[model samples]
Target: MVLLDVEGMKCGGCVRAVERTLQDQPGVQEASVNLVTRSAWLRLDPAALDPQQALEGALEALRSRGFSAQPRQSGVLSANAEPDRAWGWWNQWRQLMVALVLLLLSVLGHLAEAGTLSLPLIGTLPFHAGLATVALFGPGRSILRSGWAAAISGVPSMDTLVSLGVGSAYIASVVALVWPAVGWPCFFNEPVMLLGFVLLGRFLEERARRRTGRALKELAALQPSSARLVMADGSVRDVPVEMLRPGERIELLAGDRIPVDGVIEEGYSAVDLSSLTGEPLPVDAGPGTELSSGCLNLEATLVMEVRRVGRETALARIISLVEQAQARRAPIQGLADRVAGRFCYGVVSLALFTFLFWWLIGSSLWPQVLEVPVVLMDHGHGHGVHQSLGAAAQTPFGLGLQLAIAVLVVACPCALGLATPTVITVSSGLAARQGWLFRGGDVIERSAEIERVVFDKTGTLTLGRPLVEAVLMSDDPSRTIQLAASLEQTSRHPLAHALLQEAQRLNLPLLPVQDSRTVPGAGMEGTLADAPDPLRVGSLEWLRSQGVEWPAHQRDAVEAAQTGGQSLVAVSLGHRPIGLVAIDDRLRPDAVTALQRLRSQGLSLGMLSGDRRQAVERVGQTLGIQTDEMAWQLLPDQKLERLECWRQSQPVAMVGDGINDAPALAAADLGIAVGTGTQIAQDTADLVLMGDRLEALPEALGLARRTMRKIRQNLIWAFGYNLIALPVAAGVLLPGFGILLSPPLAALLMALSSVSVVVNALSLRLP
Candidate 1:
């Protein structure tokens, strides 16, 4: 699979166009284009067997289809380096500037000719006609070209709609000027006003559109440009990061960024991983510790051997994931895309029908059925002497043509095109800034439909770190623990950490162990240097296998703590049971409140764990989770199977932070990863909470629901606006109330519609 950056993708229709172009090519297996980020991730057939050839073929296909595409990774071939680019903003600004001036000129001239004021060369037929001509072919030239291209391609865009409307108004005005017998109302300012408003709206919308990719751009910019290369003789040279290969040594100083993924060979430091993980805490690292790119080294000088470089580094992988997720289409967006795909064709057909209906069907009717009044529009230029001063003064053909221009001008595709993508882009950017990652709009769509949330106990709900809750049933508890810690000296288990931490706290002596061996699912066994018998620290069942007897007095407390879900590790010396360690993992500080908030929304909540039944039940009860909703002692696959079963009825989201939970996270309808968790967990998750706060989960959910709501509302308004405005522009109400929409008024309404959608989308800033 390869990721490519695509340009000129404005809406869902553009998404379809690019995908269709790429997918139809030979050797291409699939193409998914994202409108929000202007990128395409393509999967190709392995049987074809040539990456360079395939990429070049794909690029050529897209370029021919009027698109600009290039591989995001450096050194890859882009068949055409200079794909057709639209006129730059400076040109657009110049066009808008000219259009604005001409529009003002026409307005002033109209006012002067209306007998309200005096202004020279402003509102005459000759001057206004000349100004309208410049506006049509000048500032509005790109719109006309793009519209014509889309129409010829059989997919009219928003540009096509505006082009037709503006061109029609200008043509009608010129004909009226050249031939008085046509007797049409010559409103030359209509085209100038329409181009001015359209250009200004495009300029503003493009600026907002660029902001949607701000997070991705920032992520890309985080990569270091150079690294301190350490030579074999201890000499150092600053070299470009791309020149460093795996296994090369690099020197990192205090306050310097780690240039690539590497393993430390010397020194120690507290590295600030906040930029990479979204957690504000600095992590302590020492020799033998592995570090990824994009971390800041604080307060130490260290030397490390590089392990991964370029796209293979963790930072690059994260950037790639974020970019792809930004592009992934949400379920709601698919519905919007389907509509946008044919939206232009529908608008054009309706405009034509309106023109025909007014000219052929409604022309025969008189004042009762259709009022063609005595008034002249004054046509923005002085009316001929034969024209009346009262309303509706044009001939039937002239009235019909005027209404047609209004129909074309009033309908806008910009609202529909901008509706969902703008909101998705802005909301995703907002989520990124909050230390939460919404992988794709689809996750947001699924999150909005979430009915059940399943959480993994260890790390996800609890801290995954166990503490010594209580110690009992022995004359010499400290001695028993010191002996146990000796056996667990090399183990990294959470239980081992609990015992060792307590030993370290009291400065207990640890005896050396010889012939230490892991019992696998039981515990550990080893011989102390001075002891004749083997020392064993393991489960209660494992100690019984060695025939160790437990004290009767401690059984009740053991049962009580077990019922409360504390982990028990028994110590046996010379085949007799010694004192036990009661260890338990505490729940996260915000777990209860976060769970309560989710429940308040009427969502079903559940927990899954590999812990014993009693332990799982105790934690579930404490968190208000019912017995039926909780699953216990399950393996990774079992957790996945359970999620698959639950999702059959409703959408389920799995939250986990362990390597064992990666499968279930990937299997669920949506997977949310806790940032403090394992790398595997973060990779598998569709949504990631980078902060150590569980409360942020609820906020992320609300944001997705709200963003989707905005998308739906925008779609409704866009569709409804056109359905009602098209007929009115066609003079549907003319026969009853003699109402006909003027072309200039229709142009203003069209511009306002685009502005409303853009403003509504921007309103999705997190509350």
Candidate 2:
């Protein structure tokens, strides 16, 4: 699927060599070469060889054969897909060298003829003509072999035409030289000059092809050469990272990258997490915290147990995805493949038609047609009413040459083959650099059409870590706040962190309470260090058992907070009820601005959270998510079901972080998981936001839209190139307009068409 412009292909032999190299790969099922077009098509499996790898294999094969190829850039090759072509510079250099030698000999022969000086015996020879033939037959022999084969097979291609025309002209000159009676005009110099010029074009083409293939090379350059291996028994040994296996330990020195994704078993240091998660901030890592490859070790030596190896690593997986995307054949490339297939058949038909048409109309129709030997000699140049038919109108080689040239020039499927892959490759590479990895081209494309954004409440829209908003008081504020914060500090709950954070922020002096006991659903109880009473914070039933009076006003405040969806903390001192503290969770700083941008893009934002109704409403209102439009206190499964229900009429995207949210994330047409969310949630989601910012969501959607537009543009150009070139190559306009396209002109146009498609795809950079 990788589009490449290869050069150095001069004949069928060269084509076969390149094809063999690609077919050797396990994933490459087939490879087709159009010798006339100087292009090769490869179909591969993403599971085996990725696009970057495939491209490298193809380019190296061409180079080994003395041809240099590159991927064509958009506009530089095709407006849609670029032609996998090679520069003609190598051929040009060889031709130039030949021409210089030939020119020197021609001048020497001219001088020897004048007898200005006595020349050596070697100088007496006709070196000009001899050297000219050598240049045409040696390095440039591939064109001759391919062209001769087509003409003899009667399935003449561009090669057959150019070869016949040039060969006929050369042989005619030789015939005249030997016989001196069949006065055939001498155009020997033209063939020699044409050979030189053609090689120049080929060399230039080969160089361009080589340049375009650099995308894969650049991608492969990202992996490091070796890894630091941490052995057992506390000793460290250096080993090649590729040789390391799963379950092995790797020690990362300061400034080294974490070689594999693993947990820090025993170490503490400020580590740079930028490469793995795209988070620029350095995070402190200690025992039990996991890390991925490419994360830099900044402060301390650490041990990381290897969890994945080689291609199984996260960085390796990302690289694989991008490579596969580049090599993938979209529907657009198939059109080009079909057109080139048809064009191959069409050219052969035209060659036969040209040969037959002349036989039918000529005066010596029977004798001249039957007389192969005589026709081969004089080319049936007998004066019979000055018969003008087909090749007879020009030379015997003229009509067939033109037809073959048309086929070769018009049948290049470079434009069709290159359009989509080139754009995808370049864009995907850039995306990887930016830390936004797209799973596939189609996902990137579909993201552009999103009209509404749905955020999962717990881990997506909010910080997931609930922080205490305010502590409302009724009777005894100290007993209420202190008891609530202290009990939470001993528990392992998200709400506990919120309570502890609130206490720390307010600088509340923590009491040295003893025998602290948790009541599960009710709350907790403990004895204060200097007080005679045991304090208790629990439900009303628990308070009632303790003989505490539930004041109507305190009950009213608790009820109001509960109705508003806030969790209430009830306090009791000795056997009597005290004041209560009502705490609520707040929103993250970036949520409002991101939601506002999504709204501007014509999206109606809604939230689905398991948090209490009042807590959900507070966040929803703060971020402009309509309170009426929200679904509060929703379980993970319920959230998924709600999204499915909403999808009956429109596309729905669910964003979440909790394990409960996994099913919902999977059920949504597009599921976006926050990086801070649980592992299972990220695994279930279609896209993972690697950073804390939700704003990247809108940008990703925008990139998807641009990618789709570019794909469409490339498809159009791919189809359009063939639509216009096919009929013209078939000589459809010749009878009416007398406008027959020359072989070279057709070749140039075919190449230009592919370049146009590639260039069009590159325009994804716009907007």
Candidate 3:
């Protein structure tokens, strides 16, 4: 994926043009342009073309089409760095101020013409014409140039409409000033008012967009620029964070943001992780505690061994994910994009139709409108000022031209383009802060539709740290445990940890094992060095399949273990039963509450596990899951099949934290991985809970629903505003109620339409 910062995009039409430009390049598979972020994300095919050449060609294409394009800086920390804009906020503010002065002078000219003021020089046609000229070539020059360039490139945008409206009004007034015999009205005030309103609206809209992206900015700000590197000789030197590498030691003092992901080697401190996890209180940390980048060391000085740095840091990954999420288009957004792609052309055509309608037919049909006052200056006393409709309508062309300008300026394509991405961008940042990382907008959409959630047994609802409770069916219990621990020592299964811990507690020596192998969702088996028969250790079901038999007398022990909610493992030698091990894992502290919360939200809950039916049933009863919703003694593939069956009825979400759960997770409608899970599990899942907090499951689902709701509201407003505002601007209401929207008023409404969509998206940031 290639990321580029693109400038000069003014609306949905611009977004479509940028996207089309990139996607048309050789080797480019897909291109997405975000108007809110003013960035482009391109996916390319490496086999078709060299990536470097493709990037250069794509940049050249954008430049040729009149956009300012450059490669975006790599790394999450760089996102906080401001881009160098030729016309920055201060320059834009100065331009707005200039336009404001011009607008005031023009308003004064109108007031003087109305006889409310006695300023002869200010009311003169040449004076107002000079003010309009400065406003046009000064504050509105960029808009005109960009709009003309876009039109030449065959991709007209919102700027094109504004330019045409303002330019035509100026030129027509200039013609009247040069030759009054043409019978045209000279109203130089229109252009100045239009530009002033456009500038003001853009200023406010830019401010609101900045606020919508605050969460991403805050995340980028959490990484410190430098770190204090601890030398081999115990001396410390401050070094740039990017220069640090794995195994290098760093020193952190109180109030310092952690520069890299590391493990504490010495000292202790309370670190604030609110920026990463949204946790309110600072967490206590000691030696050996794992610390992620961007957390603040709050209470004491500490030394850490860097494990990950630069783009590999947790903070960087979060930022990248958020950016990718914002770039992804939702399904509903496709409709908006399709409409916005041709919206400019359609609006231009409508404006032309509006001009022809009024000039050719409506002028004669509604001649009464000509006598109606165009401004406050029109009254019983004829002032002979051309500002009044009666004077301007000396020819029907004047009324038609005025209404056409309103139609052109009032139709907005930016609102349609911004409707979805702004919401997705805001929600992505918010979810990152809350410790949930949604893959993209599509995942957010699917997550909102999930009607059932299935949880894995171990390491998901359970603490995943089991302990050995009893050893059975063996004359020498110590020998049985030693044998099992030797085979399980290298495994990551929770039961393997239990057996190793038991062996450690008993201080038993493990015999060396060879030719060891693990069966997923089952057990481990290997050969003891001096043993005549290979020692096999696994679940009774797995061992039975291996020709090992359960003794009739030991049935009582197995029953007792299962009734107590203990998972039992069988040990066999040469197909002879040796012993059974009972391991028990406790439930997570928040499991019960989290499950209850999910159920209360009208979502059904289920549990899938490889444990015995009795143990699975015990957990299901405790969590209030129905018996029919619980499946036990299932292999990884069986779990996937069960998930598919559930999905046949409703959208199902699988939550798991183990490698065995990866298949089922990927097969579900939405896959939610626990942060404590294996890397493969996290990689396969659609959403990851970074804090490993089960309570966040409900929060994640709720956030998805809320984000989708906000998107719907924005689309509705965008579509509805255009539907109602366009016709009114074209004078559809003029014949009925004599209500015609003026060009300046149309400009104001158009600016507010885009701003309203952005402000609504920003509301998701609120509580």
Candidate 4:
């Protein structure tokens, strides 16, 4: 997948155009454009695509849209780099300088008229007003051009209303000057004021937009530029990761990303798998072990064969998942679209009705008695023909024009289009930086509403790995372990590994054994050369039938192991009882903290595992969950059944990491798959946690809540602005309360709301 910075993108249509252009290129599997960020991301077939050439093609597509395009060298690959800050600041400064100059001139003109100026030359008011016009028309031509295009096309965008008001006001003023009115002249200063004020808002909005894009920039910085490839001669050479191939050996240095997923062919070390699986534990590896890409090599040098490289690697695929998820649009943005589409029609209808009502009133005798006659008598109209006509037209035309300009200015719908999506975009990006992958805007919205959470035991609620805790013997401990090792050596089960590990720990040596055989369901049977009969390891019933009496102390140890939710393995030598080995699984490091945070969020946390009742209960108690909150001895289907039952009452999110948990993952309202689990579990889940830490689940939930909050705020602001401003711009309040907004003023308000939403979203940092 590739995300390239592009230029000149302005709206949804521009985004669609860039998307289509990039999709036309061969091997480009998918393409999306973020207009706000001025970027285009592409997923492609690596075998058929050349990265450098693809970027060049994208540049060509952008140029066709009338904007300069090139690969941003500093942050070309990262989604989190803010190399665009320099350009963003430049864009801001250009707008600010023009607006500030205009503002100074307008304020000076107003001050000069009030006799506040000491120097007449410095207060050359006409020249300042004309200079403001030049600033508005020349330096700020992009806004005018975009607005004019939308207006001419009859789209009636936020741009259209602003253009209509500013352009009309300024042009009318020029007309009034070139051909001075035979009555009171109109003022063009409002248009200048609108441009200056709106530009100030744009400057604020641009600063925020640039900050939001930095999340992507930071993500891009994580890529490792070079890898140390181990050559056949046993020497290492630094090479670019892109140049590595399948079957080639690579040596990982400490703190380096595993360039590709592969098997460890040599070396022994503890590897930090947190970055890849989110698992906090460092896995110790020796020869003939699997190592995934993006895992940090934390110990001795690791030699691994590259099985998957470039885009086919696990790290690349995960990056793709997050980038795709971040591009999803939120539901609240639809409200903006609805408002923008109908705003023009609604406002025009009201304006027409107002005009008709006034025209009808003019035809009535009321205009002569209440308006025209009053004006004529004030100017003493009987004295001159010019005097009568000027008084009749001057006051009314000037006031009506001013009111129309105000209405058009106040009707800009920029906020209606920007509010919700901008918030979603910025918040989602912030969440992504913290390692939460929100599948879509709805997940962020829905997750915030979750009230209950169900956890799968084994890997989720407790540490899943079993360890040998104790070994008890009825006979000589050495003789019993040696015999037990011989029997267990032939069996394949988790209990077997525990037994053998315990035997090894005791330094017990296995005597030469013959006729060694494993009874599939029963256990194992084998005869040592020194033994007079076959040694057996099976159930207590089989041992009793062999005339073996259970030792009292060994019986107590077995019972104690069961109570602790541990596996008990019994061994026998000849016809006599021997020893017992107790093994149990441990809890994860972050389970307690995760549970506490989820509980704080008002989610009822419960544990469900396939382990025995005692084992599951042990884990729940250790994590501070009450006995009523734990469920055990559940198969995959049973887990799903429990999840379904809970889902009926409230939204539930199931967090698990094994294949057995997949069914429940699918059944839950939101399936949070941990990164450390099996392949099937990762594929089956709806939302994959990039790390193995259960703590991330609550972190993600917190981030999701923030994102949803921002979305709601943005939607409310956008919707509220339209609800209030649209009615006033359409003159709904004019007839009764005389409240109306000009087009320039409407545009300014719309832009302010849009910028506010984006700024609010950008405020979500990792508190």
Per-candidate alpha-carbon RMSD to the true structure: 4.3, 9.7, 5.9, 7.3
Q: What TM-score fits each model?
A: 0.86, 0.68, 0.86, 0.77
Model 2 C-alpha lDDT versus the unseen true structure: 0.58
Residue lDDT tens for model 2, 132-192: 5875687457778866654454333345544654565456556645765543333334345
Reference-based lDDT, residue 757, model 3? 92
Residue 374's lDDT in candidate 4: 28
List the candidates ranked by lDDT, beginning with the highest. Answer: 3, 1, 4, 2
Model 4 agreement with the true structure over 1-767: per-residue lDDT tens digits: 55566665443434444566777877777765554656555777767768667667767755654545554333234433445656667876887787778767766655664467765654353654476478667655777887665545444455555576677667656665566653434354556667776777777777777677676555544557788988878888999988998999988766777767789988898987755554657889888988776677887877888898776666565555555555544555555555566666555555445445444442242333223332211212212111111123344444345445555666545555455556566765665554556655656766777888888877666556666666665447666667777777866687777668777888877667788877765667788787777788765555666677766756775666556666666677776777766667767777788889888888898888777887777777778888877788887777778888888889988888736677787778887776543344336776666655778888788877887777677667766776786555544544444344544445567668767877777777647
Query: What's the lDDT for residue 342 in model 2?
Result: 48
* Alpha-carbon deviation at 226 in model 1, angstroms: 3.2
Note the Cα lDDT for every prediction shown: 0.76, 0.58, 0.84, 0.64
Highest lDDT: which candidate? 3
Please, what are the lDDT tens digits per residue for candidate 1 over residues 195-220? 88777766776666666666656665
Which 10-residue window of candidate 1 scores lowest in summed lDDT? 74-83
The better-scoring model by TM-score among 2 and 4 is: 4
